[model samples]
Target: MDSHGSSNGLREEEIDAVAMAVIAVVVNTMADKESSSCNMLMRLRQRRALLQSVAEAPDCAATCEAVVQLCVALTSGVFPRLTPRWWIKRRTGGTWEDLRLRDDATDEYFRQKLRMSTTMFNHIVAACAAYMEKKVTHYRMPLPVEQLIAFALYRWVSGETYESGTSAFGIGRATGLQAFRDVISALLQAYPDAIKWPMGRRRAQILRAFREKGFPNCFGAIDCTHIYIDKPAGAPSENYYDRKQKFFVQAQVVVDLDLRILDVHVGYPGSVHGVRVLHNSQLFRRAESGELFDATPENLPHYVVTRGYLLGDNGYPVACPWIVSPYGGIDQGADEERFDTRQKVARGCVERAFGRLKCMWRLFLRTHKTNLETLPQQFVVVCTLHNILLDTGMDFDENLL
Candidate 1:
């Protein structure tokens, strides 16, 4: 084949190239017209055919490449623009001015939106600002710390899209997203200090609270909930799909009597059973390896014949020394029945904690639209904020239900 034009009036390759270009234009035009149609299955089939043709196109490599690119653009979505409006592109130019003008509201309005009292929110803003300033280099330098805090909290609590969050925060969609991520990253950096197992007086307080509830040995209640996300395109979707037929990741949490989260383990696929999740958790690992609660048999709870324990639902294993599940079957003694009842009452904390957690940070209940890898970290940030809310004497708002 010649790289330059042929001396003849028209070359064979030129004719083929013109034909392919016409095909590309026609296909793209059809795609744009059908993009918003309700018939998605039909659209998918057409796109699949187009992709196959592109792959099988003959020796005209340049034409094949152009057709392939056009097909991808057409099949992806409606209104495919040549210029992408990603957040980085709007770094210096944002809608923050728009947000400031509309944000004149009462403290209660702020509380409802952020799911925290004014005092609690202010405290966190101060803590996160101070902590993140020392750690992150020139973090979102143009945006005010309060606006950044509001933007992050609004996204987390409302489960809004990044585009909507940007509009609300008066910034570029990408900037709003980056700000939320930076805040969460900074929070994770401080996770060790902010979210920790109770120690000394705190431990004594937790134990005392459990004892008062008629479960003398219970330190925390354990349970798991799924955080839904979009299934990836190339990966095995079945692995991420749950028994409920939804795509999600599992989050296992242990909550103390006051509804404070003591430990959290997230990032497992939803297909995994709750017990299996617990088995894979660091808490379980440490307990099995004899490092978590290194106390003598004499120091263990009297109710447990082997070791100390946390109250858990029937989804957990009864044989695990560190976890106590209620008795099963119809024929049970009165003592067994009574013990089961009390355990149920005590273990209710975990369920309530999850309920409040989801209610306050509605993001957990929504299908998180971010990258799959980033979803778990966002869940951890929500759990971290939940702990912060409980620690600051902030009560779960009943109205959110």
Candidate 2:
């Protein structure tokens, strides 16, 4: 009799008898079907790599095994036969229910197996664990934290609803909502300086990085993305509209060459025009004070800003300091066209940065679940994490954007 049996309410003698009987049954069964049992065990071992975990400790490791079992139960019906796109369940395409795990069968099997692997969990664990501590409090248990956070970011990027996050991320309704907020909060707090400076030595390095090309000192790519927010239930907010007229929170962001957000203005009450927001922003003031300085090439241009430019889209007012879109019919020459192409290419950095930030960390993108009043602080947090990812050189999925 073992203490474990007693914990299960079985008396010691009774447990001992049942254990011996079970052992005898296993021995007899294994002897009668040795090859079959061995093959079954081998199959189980092969699939063990696909599980998720909280930590590497034995208990946490076991929880990962449990996840594998759950996945198997849910996915086994379609594993070998189903196509990857098909297995997604809610998809309406013909690919539905025929999901192929990979290009080849064995590779697909191994791919599925990795879901249970300690190595795989290690990566998810990296994002879920202490990596975010610089911005969040410490709390580790309940492995669902990994999936919840992963799905929250995915939902934001996909522009799906919060309910989609819950179902896709395997989080309960309440947990799904709370986790979206918690992960975003932790990220913003951990990397308070996620939005880095395009200044000093850093600015010099960026200039040098692009100096070989014809482009001169470029501070950052400036752009405004219309973040659609839930409108105030009560307000006289007709001004938020453009000539086309739409309700959205106009957020202006400036990201350095590395795609790290340098500055953001998000509290414009969902009605302010992009031009108005920038006019009052600190970025405009700093540029006006003749503050942007050159680090080398001792020409010492009268306005250091005269040498540098903020790459902007068609919506912005462009100048020597602000490289706005090409002037109407300004086909000065092929070289000018080449420069225009480069500027447009460079302008994408900000839009792509916003796309990635919203995709990876959902605190932005203005979901209906978010409180209207909390938008400002949430905007700050999302921008901050966007920079942290840049600093870390974390591999973000470009194809997603």
Candidate 3:
């Protein structure tokens, strides 16, 4: 009857009949002869259209019963919004000073929430502040770099979702996520300056620490651990599911005696073996080419065959000469048994490193529901921060060297 229904190919006679029927009903309902029935019907339709347009206007302030009905129709799950109503809440994590002075076991509580001492946290904030700084004038929220770093650290250590962290940190979910990503990216950019294997005097210090533990010639302990991740969508997911029946990414690490991460090779899929992970690592490639561990042999104990080597478990090949694994169990002698025992003890450093790493950075302890592309960068940031914590005297007593 109206233009809205005319496009459906109604016969002219049918349209006229429908229009006349609508006009007759309207004429009977009202006593106003001031307008014709057809004109009145058209005016009624126009008013309905106006009500709908008002209801949908994003900036309109005035509303009526019609507007409320229109809202119910729009949000009845028939049409979805980019950001749901529940997501737009006030952002809330308090300031770092507020956390530091929180009256509830302040020192230990801050450490529990961030997995680092206040002093160390300050140092880290300082290290990356230049990269994460954002100006906050009267026009926008005062998003300080320190608060951004704190929010990111809180999320990483507590493994809280964006929604939960925003409520505590006093920010929106979108801001929380963006700050978390920004802080992680800044931390990764600081990696080359912060987390590096020892060389020269530092290498000597690490070697000495290993020698004290009765494993001479050991520069670091190498191993791989699976960091849980969500299965990627589509065909590429098969590459991420491992023998453990979980989706994960392999993290190859080389740690010093003090549980400090010296080198890390992250981003390999779980299906890749530890050995293959090492083979693809820069550390392994350097070792094979004799570019690493090239320090001149110095006077040492007879049991110490070389100046630099990495202690690995049976998962790696001992043929590399730089990386040593236990001998085969079959037909082994007391000497081989003793070597295996000592090697296991020496290799505990890497295992302990993994333990503390997972404990301090809770992000790695559970399955990460994040985009697969972002998981690798997150892993690298955690590793880098772990090393940075070690630099600031953070202790892990699991395997004290």
lDDT of 2 by residue, 256-356 (tens): 66777778877675567667788888878877766653444323335443456667766666543445465435546876677677776766778788777
Provide the global lDDT of candidate 2 against the true structure: 0.55
How accurate locally is residue 33 in candidate 2, as Cα lDDT from 0 to 100? 27
Give the distance in Å from residue 152's predicted Cα in candidate 2 to where it truly belongs.
3.6
Global Cα lDDT for candidate 3: 0.71
| Model 3: pairs clashing at backbone N, Cα or C within 3 Å | 91-170, 91-171, 92-168, 92-169, 92-170, 92-171, 93-168, 93-169, 93-170
lDDT for position 347 in model 2: 66
Q: Model 1 residue 78 lDDT?
A: 26
Off by over 4 Å in 2: 1-151, 167-178, 199-201, 230-239, 269-271, 290-307, 318-326, 329-342, 354-370, 376-385, 391-398
Q: In terms of TM-score, how similar is model 3 to the real structure?
A: 0.71
Q: In order, what lDDT does every prediction score? A: 0.71, 0.55, 0.71
- TM-score quality measure for candidate 2: 0.54
Query: What is candidate 3's lDDT per residue for 1-401, written digit by digit as tens?
Result: 56654444454465445445434543343332244577667656654564445434332232234345444643442122233336455434564446747465776766778877777777778888878877633223346787788888888887777767777777777787788788888887755666686878888888788878776667888888988877776538889887778998888888888888888888888888888888888987787777778666745445555756888887887677788788867888998888788878888988888888888778789887765667778878888888777777766545322
